[model samples]
Target chain A: MDFQPTEERRMLADMIGKFIQNDYPMKARLTAGTSALGYCPEAYSKMAQLGLIGALFDEEVGGFGGSGFDIATVFTELGKGLVVEPLNDTAMTSGYILAHTDQLELVEQIILGQKRVALGLIENGADYDWSAPETLAHQTGSGWQLSGMKTCMKFAHGADALIVSAQTQSAPGISLFLIEAAAAGLSEHSFQTVDGGNACEITLHNTPAQLLGAEGAAYPLIDAAAARATLAVCAEALGVMERIKDMTIDYMRTRKQFGSVLGKFQALQHRVAQMLLEIEQAQSAVINAANDLQSPTDERNRAISAAKYSIGRIGCAVAEEAIQLHGGIGMTWEYDLGHFAKRLVMIDHEWGDQDFHLIRFSES
Target chain B: MDLNFTEADQAFRQEVIEFLNAELPADISRRVHADLHVSKEDTEFWHAVLHKRGWLTFNWPKSFGGVGWSPVQQFIFEEECAAAGAPRILPFGLKMLAPVLMAFGSKEQQEHWLPRMCDGTDWWCQGYSEPGSGSDLASLKTTAVKQGDHYVINGQKTWTTLGQHANMIFCLVRTNSECKPQAGISFILVDLATPGIEMRPIRTLDGGQEVNEVFFTDVRVPASNLVGEENKGWTYAKYLLAHERNGIANVGISGQKLARLKRLSLSQKRRGKPLADDPLFAARLARLEIELRNLETTNLRVLDEFSKGAGPGPESSMLKIIGSELEQNFDDLTRRALGRQAQAHMPEVFEPGYNGPQVAPQDMANQSAAYFNKRKVSIYGGSNEIQKNIITKMILGL
Candidate 1:
């Protein structure tokens, strides 16, 4: 079995990687993260023009690629630059959900950067329990009236619309609704997350929305979208962990403390070697998960959960050890390690923390 | 065999509490307790307060203007100050150099520098760790050549903690390269105002200018600045390092940080309950508490040895390794408790009256930075690796 990505995927990865490296410096990323719009619209448009967003979807949905490997490749570059954009929420999860419905045109707009959408599957206090949504939708004469709160809605502040998961009175299970940003009785409380990205706590007071997919049949779509998102973040974490490992090695080679470079210390050498082994193991997990994306329900879920769990544990270990090995220099805001470490550690909090995934792995 | 403090020791502890309550500046203590930044001015102000109360030199001999408190009394005072959030007494002047001078300095050196150190007239910084030096401090390349009545010094020193505020530095400079590396060293004190002496800040990972790099380009100092016989600096440096390692354990500060960590865990939620209520989190916290409890006992045993007229031996290295690791662990758990909220990097929020947007809660202001900065504890003061080597040599006789 081949482990390397296809030539087309490699070219796509190179293009996106170069774009991020050339345009998105740490200062620019920080500014974009802190901006009112949450992320750089120009950068998003540039990436869209480069066909980066379209690579996450099938050509039938006005895209060139739609596979777990495609999602992983694009996001790994995003993770390298610490890009604070809404690509995952928009082009990956929301796009997947929309593609499964009759709104194929909306998916096309998403891929072209003409529309930005964020998914609202996580409810307040319902940590990753997307199967039984607490947010309820009441049937109105014309559209639908959505009334509930959604938490951890990343980039929801800047989205053109939100795809929310809710239990409807007309359905026995979870359904999907598309709520416009300017919908009546909708409110968003925005804040900056720890990783220099934006998130919102959304409240809907009988907000006007329209049904997207079939009633009581959106759980499988939501589940699949979440799996793709999980795979993307796992790959992104690999990118971040690799950068941290490289930075640590460079530091050890250059930073002398005892008449010789720190790398000469056998104890520290072992720790760095441990970091390498952990990163390799995490890479293997991500690769397995990406390949297993099209597997049956139990297998796919188990593989994704295993990767997420490994990344959650291994990413933090690598990040923490890198900082420890770099000593005082690793923790500064002016330096790049602190930011990468934060991202690596915080990735676990999203897509379910390590403990959550451990249970998911055991049960699935 | 006794674990409880004597009534007299308890009385001394109460006296320390009363003094902290009366003399400690409320604003300084408030900032320290909240883990906010303590400015240089604030630190000097606290030193002045302690000096006025005749407590600044409490660890020194009574002949050197110290109170000559018991070892247990000293421990009580340190713990109380840490609990009250008092600024740490800068060790470069008061702790590291003073012990060396008291042991090896002539009467003139002691009379001049000791009083200045106590009155805050001369801020001191250690220049023992050069860029190429650190754990191998004896291999330092900074040199001082004898020139008539003056010695010309030329070399660079890095990791000079708080050298920006220091008017004086105690450095170990190479005197005679013809001999062994450890034997050719000499400990000499230099004034920051000396011509050709320069100090540049080395900003730490926490975005702090707490340490610096000092350069000496043919800086001239009086030959009398030398503390002991020429080429005998290595012995004095080793003595100073032993003294430094004893305090590096920082049992009191770690205890204070542990308290803060528990307080934070109580407020942070996980699985819709307080993180402290989570069984896994609670178990880790319990393990840490046990470790700290054992460390305190070990620290006291060492102090007890000191009381019985034995200097800190290689066992002190054990304390250093465990103490530093314990502190790093506490920092790790504290950051994890905040979850993603700890990732916010607002350095300005650490400044004492920063009215800007408080991104995270006041308690969570610098958890990530603290986690990053605490890494130095293991790397500096004879890195934990070096301490292990010392233990292997002296304790295990390996």
Candidate 2:
């Protein structure tokens, strides 16, 4: 029944929260988001120096605090500031895959922010299915040769390596392969994401790849990593929703029309109350999913799907409602709430959207 | 009692379609339909094409160089233009300012400006919303002090759509601070090239610089540019707002977007089947279609009243609210149908001669940005909340 975090996790949250408050103003975040690398490499390196990235990994792999609550605590703060770093791809998802494959050295490097690794699982038509990737890997004498197109590889433009899932010619199931970013036969078209992050459409033409784990057995691990990533975004969405709600209330309290502040009106007050209620519900969902991350597969999947679905649905409502309440200012680029709203809606577009998870929840 | 278009109206629609097919540039139509950027040249070219055909000023009386089409004919033309992906005739001059000029401006002003508007000599942008005043526009603080033959305008106006491309701006400025906020305001036209007037682009959430903030540092304008009596701007502003509210519904654009959305959904796959076939997605599209249908009917009803010589009343507020919400709904569904593919933000794809790779769906490179951009529909032009408030007071008699 205890809902509070441990003292260590609370300290972790406080440190990250303070860092965001001090170094990550909206203007700075905007600059970083549109920077050459699509994020502040210096700030990321600083976060690593602060031991923030290491907190997402287990001690066996690199550092302490690999629990779901650890991921939630770190990402919720990042989401509050709308930080555009590739932590979810480089550390959370690819780090999990590397750690599970006993690649402790690379995992340690990622934990220290020395290497950035992006996960390439989604294909053009695959939607969310990681079990039967269209990307193909052929067995070679020295290593493996991969050929496929991976779309929407988040932060792929800046990654040192990519942990890509592909179907093997010699096997019937999906497998994980680590490919260098500069490998031959690899081409990428990088573009900024709608949420101010960067992504690339990676086309592999017999690109060299090193298999990490057993062939034809990458599905379960891929599914697990996806669940973890999904939970991270859901937690992040909870953070985004909270910020939107707060900004909206602040707007209502100050913006005057008809000789009175908008908040004084009962109609607006009720909608703001509804936004608060939805945000609280989203918070509970994140907590529940975080707690269930280490549980059995079905239970974990169910909780994650429910949470993600709630976030995907409720996050949009809150984002749209916040903009409507604030009017033109909410739609402006200079205003901070608009960015939060953009991140919130685009979060649903990422990991998996509401429709994707609704189907998953029903099946789970 | 018959709901279908009359035979003559159908023939008129066919004529409009043929005219668009012949005159509308293929590139412009393709770009418009794809939601890509149409250059100022393209817009002006199309505006000139329509003006030459005497169809650009369809809303005006024939005596004022208008084609003077009936309401049904206007509806048919607009629908056909939307379906054919014609560049939207910029509403600032042709719709908003022209009506006010014809209604309140002196014969000299109308004679000078109306022809320039039709001839594409001047690109006009509205300067109504200020940084301090959006929903409550009367609270604007931009001042217009009369100085002999010219008025020295000094203040800022934000959310001026497409002002960067404009040579002229119609603004609401404070003429007298002694009176009530609404009473002291005056609507005045100013040449944007006037000294001390600086227009800085205000980037929207979609990373587009379509709107601007115009700062007036003692910019001077001719006092004769005032549309009507001094300090009577509120009356003219309200009149123009009500007059233009019916078009804010944008029923034709929604229909066009819904069609594009359906095609996108069908092209996108989910588990070996078209995303459109998925029951959940199907239900959403179906619901959007139903709502659009209801809105179309309501809009036609409004136009029906207009044909009988009735001005757009407060019921236009209902159309604004529902229409903007429906268009936003189409955006939501379009993005949803793309899933993570919509995350691709290659805005340059909309640029002419952009041969870059499309990481997402073809012609949908900006779906996410468009979704983010369309949030302005509910926020601007007297925000939907303000429309609701108007409905509450004026229509519901609350």
Candidate 3:
């Protein structure tokens, strides 16, 4: 069977690559990294103008009806720029939830860039376990009352709304609810993540929330969202890996010690080769996962878990090796190598760590 | 892109699986599964069985006594053989030399060796590396001086894998001294039993005499045994090496090893639970499995390119590098799973018939040995470092 990207997908990838090169340079990312939101709002608005945020949904949902390949293309570009935005969490995850639900109005708002949605699924003590949420929601007078703490909610301060997963009091399963950012009885404390983006601890005290979809039906949706988010992060990690590799290689070429370029040493060369190999492996997994998104249930779950496990492990390894290879410069924040490394480390732990996904994969 | 096999390909895969299930001996499969060294007789037996089915050269052209299966079918066959634990058919003849003969050998050369190679009449060994030549293979000093009708071959080839069991050796030797190093070389076929030829076994750390040091003290060989024109042997040798490196990728073998590792890990208890339950170990295993999957797909892509009439190129170098690393990684994981059992240093463990001391199962005992043995995979077949250079120059144009 063919594994090469389609001509259309290739064209999309090229376009995104060009966009990152021209619009979002490393300096721009560095500047944005110093901001409160850790990303350029103006640049993000431009991305929305290009229809990237809603790339994977149908036309009726105000999206391009683009395939997962399209989303991958956009994310790869975002990664190349080391763009510190909540697109991965907000657009990919929250947007996925909105697209799948019957709430066309909210989906339109997210698609048109009028409203931002951040995902708040991970609860206190729920160590990256997406399915087993500790947040609880009870039937209220009109709809639902949510009462739980969702920790490490990306971009909560920037979002207009939040998609929260909570256990239903009346049922034995988890349900997803959408609540306004300034809803009464909802309090948030935002802090900087390792990558310098905002992740919030949202405390919901009987917060008025509306069901995003049928109760207990959000598990599959959440799983799908998590998979998409993981793949998106992998695309970003691949970008960071490529950048780090290039920087390391360039440094070796110039940083000669013993009468020759450090790159000439076989030991260093093999290390770089190993890094490249891991990146390629991660790339293959991400692409395979993107393709598998269209497959049937069983295959999709297996492929996604396989992708997550591969990317998480390889991504972290590459980042660590990249830092090691760069010597002292890699550790300095001024050098920008630490930026990608920090982002990679954060992404590696997010959605699911390598071990978390590995267990899921083996069990599957 | 889709990974689904076509209906016809699926049927062909089923046929090959059935054949392997029916014809491959259970004891041989068991030995392979356990990573126990299979005897020469077992290899020859399976080769003969495949030869009888006209599938000995599974990837060769029908013109050369091969089954002439499509690339996908060949992949399926290999996947089946590996999954069924069929002993790996030694590739010196079928995979390495046969292709060289097909490409650069004279019609007479093809007529002489092709049939014999298929029928298990001649077991072949490589004579490329010398003590000095490893990754700098073109620096080889083995020489064959041409006289009137024959070449007087001298010098030595080290690390000749399975040379002790070989009846024939395809060698690279210096034929001209005045020219450049690579230019002066030639590819020649030699009878290992010829006069003045000697093979001394080199016992590896695994305590197995699988490799040999072959010496030629003025061994005479017919000049007609040269595969191609004199002084062009380097080209032919290079051609043969591309195939050798590709075969060394051994995706099917890696897949088989990974499956076996999974089973072994599941059987071993760690902290009152299977080793597979250990998240870190499971994660590493999963990561390796995923990498192996990617390698498998890339290999299939390479095979598809080959079926379209392309020869092995720099992409093959990528395969060799990744494949060898993945193999070594799998072995490392298997060793790690063995843990304390892996530290057992009884040299007698790998002997032909020596059962001594209370030990882990034979399989677990062999894990460390396998790991140590595989350390050379990245070093041999042109070290992964050299492969990166090839990729840098040929592919990335660095």
Candidate 4:
């Protein structure tokens, strides 16, 4: 039950942190977020070249054979950069799901940066039901056919393939299918997320799909993928928290109000101190959840729920407080503080909102 | 960095758990779970039980009649006790003053007082906070003028927790006026029954008489009662304060309260479902649990450092800050879980044989009382604001 990151993991985190700080600053994210694809494919290719996309899988599956902590390290750095990329959705979630299947060729393509995939888990009006899919899949004479709409398909425009969840007619159970973007009867309507990332409402009308695993066995796979996605979001939230703390401290030091720096005021100081404490708590939860990712079933589920619940609750509070403490400038789109807050709010509600995660955690 | 308990530690944990299950009286445990103030008889009964088990002075050295458990073992013992609803040991003697006495007192002082403290024969209260000198404790104005062979003490001490129940008090008194405020102070041990001393209970927001205001009008005390040098009381006071601040962390107590909150939340219904099923409340509870976990780990780290023979320094300030906030937050959540029930009861219900006001339910009669009582956590053992200042100066060098 060691919660501390390994020394190598720490080094990896530091390296990623430096890379994000030097290469993908807020301006870069702002520029990329406004792009047609919502993220820089060139930057993502660079990340793939650095072997960060396949951090949590085996070398045989075209990965670095790193543990969940390694992936968390990368995601946390990406979060600090407020990177408007689908690294979390594609690399962590879809990549993890692909690695577990027998599709080595597809996994290798994703690992080699030749192809990208985005997870389409949240269907329209789904409302936090990860297992109760609104989309339906039917086994056809040719292969499988998917028909429904998945809203908030993250980075959908950039992804060459989509790993989606649908209920099959035979078992009426949620299953996952990998569908190519150019398949017949596939359409995407792209829009901007609150954080300036590209999200799409993907409509599938008898879209040709390949079953990733055994029929109706993909629920657990999707669950694991969702857990991975949650931890990645938590890591990113922590990154934003760290930035807020640093920025708040910097503002306190320089921005004087009433003949003294705001940091000198006990009220503001206590508020910042509280923000640090919440971030630390969330950090512990994320590390614990990441460590439990491959552990026994019950413990893994408990840790994941606990992590998501803790992060969703504290992350949103910290983000909101960060904006409030920054005063009027924080509300403007021109300010980076609002950008981080927006990302935090979006990520907080992505896998499950605080309320949704809390119910799952308590029931578990 | 590992949180896993060793097999031996687990066995020790089981032993403690078993003892608590077998030995703790059901009524006492119920009172503890209910957050009701335990009777003096119940407190003494548990104290005797622990004393017989040779665990009364859990933090004392073996040579001083203690279990002499390792730091982790002590942590486990405290945690298990709190979790099992055991009454908290009065710490003015055992946890706070004993360490200072061990470090600075004469051998005779240790021999005369340590055994009594271990046997729970002497209940001690602290006389540090005065009307004007709480956060700035060294500025206390209580004076002890040296008379023939004794010091005549005069001045008042307010917010003396449990002082009305104490037979003795350890105090910080001004002995020399020329030196700095801290340098002019001397640590004095005074008998509460002294002729010129008077104690008046101060009713707190908590609706309990846990603290008192003690007035001294030329209370005479033998010069021998002085623990260390006459004008060096500030150093001893600081030492005592470090211990107080560390105990003020109260992670074990907070952890127990968190568990109780969970049970209450599970049983209580909100919006046609258990409060535990309410996503908002559940998220809040989970966040508290995570914070408590981090606090527990940080506390263990501090304990590990202490076991290496290093006393708590300014880092204890950090513990105080985090611990008090967490405790307050837990109480707030509990109150939130209690909902309107938290405000339904009057303070009089906590008194003996009240039965005057008809409350919502038997369980909720004390909810407001508990909430009011917990409000003092941030104010006592030095305010958390003071703790932050200490951290800022010590760690941040601001």
Residue ranges of candidate 4 with Cα displaced over 4 Å: A1-364, B244-247, B346-364
Model 1, range B257-367, lDDT digits (tens) per residue? 889878877776665667788666788799999999998888888888888988757877888899999988988777666654554555656565766544345646577
Q: After superposition, how far is residue B284 of candidate 4 from its true place, in Å?
A: 0.8
- RMSD from true fold, candidate 2: 1.8
Tell me the whole-model lDDT of each prediction, alpha carbons only.
0.83, 0.86, 0.76, 0.77
| Model 3 pairs whose backbones collide | B186-B233, B187-B233
lDDT of 2 at B237: 89
Per-candidate interface DockQ score = 0.35, 0.68, 0.01, 0.01
Misplaced by over 4 Å in model 2 are B147-149
Q: Using DockQ as the measure, which candidate wins?
A: 2
Candidate 2 chain A — worst ten consecutive residues by lDDT sum?
A124-133
How would you encode candidate 3's per-residue C-alpha lDDT over A197-269 as one tens digit per residue? 6666678998999988888778888887777787777777777777877888897787654346768988889
> Which ranges of candidate 3 are over 4 A from the true structure?
A1-364, B244-248, B345-358
Tens-digit per-residue lDDT, B1-398, candidate 3: 77788999988988888898799987788678767667899999999998888788778877776677887787778788888989888888888889988998999999989989877789999998886565567878889998889999999997888888899999999988897888999999999989999998775534456778899999999989988788898787667667753345678888888888888777865545677988788888999999998988888888778879887677778888898889878876775565333433333445556554323445454554455455567766676767888888988988
Tens digits of per-residue lDDT for model 2, A1-364: 8987899999998998999988878887888877657888888888998999898888888778878899899889888878888889778789999999988889989989899998888885326655567888998788899999888888888789999999887889889999999999999888888878788888999899999899989888888898889989998888888788888888898988777899999988999999898889899889999999999999999999899989988999999999889887787888888899988998887777788888988987
**In Å, what is the interface RMSD of model 3?**
17.5
TM-score of chain A of each: 0.98, 0.98, 0.94, 0.95
Residues B1-398, candidate 2, lDDT per residue (tens digit)? 88998899988988998898899887788788766556788889989999899988887878888787787788778888888899988999988999899999999999899999999999999999886688888898999999999999999998898888899999999999997999999989999889999999877788778888999999989889999889999989888888884457788888999898888878888877888888899999999999999988888888899889887678778888999899899989888888777787777886779898886777788888888888888988888888999999998889
Task: For candidate 4, write residues B1-398 as lDDT tens digits.
Answer: 67887898899999999999989987688678767877777888898999989888877878787787887888888888988889988888888889888989999999999889877779899999886566567778899999999999999998887887799999999999888787899999999999999999775533356778899999999999999898998888777767753345678888888888877776765545677987688888999999999998898888778878886688788888788779878865775565423333333444556654332234444654464455566667766667778788878999
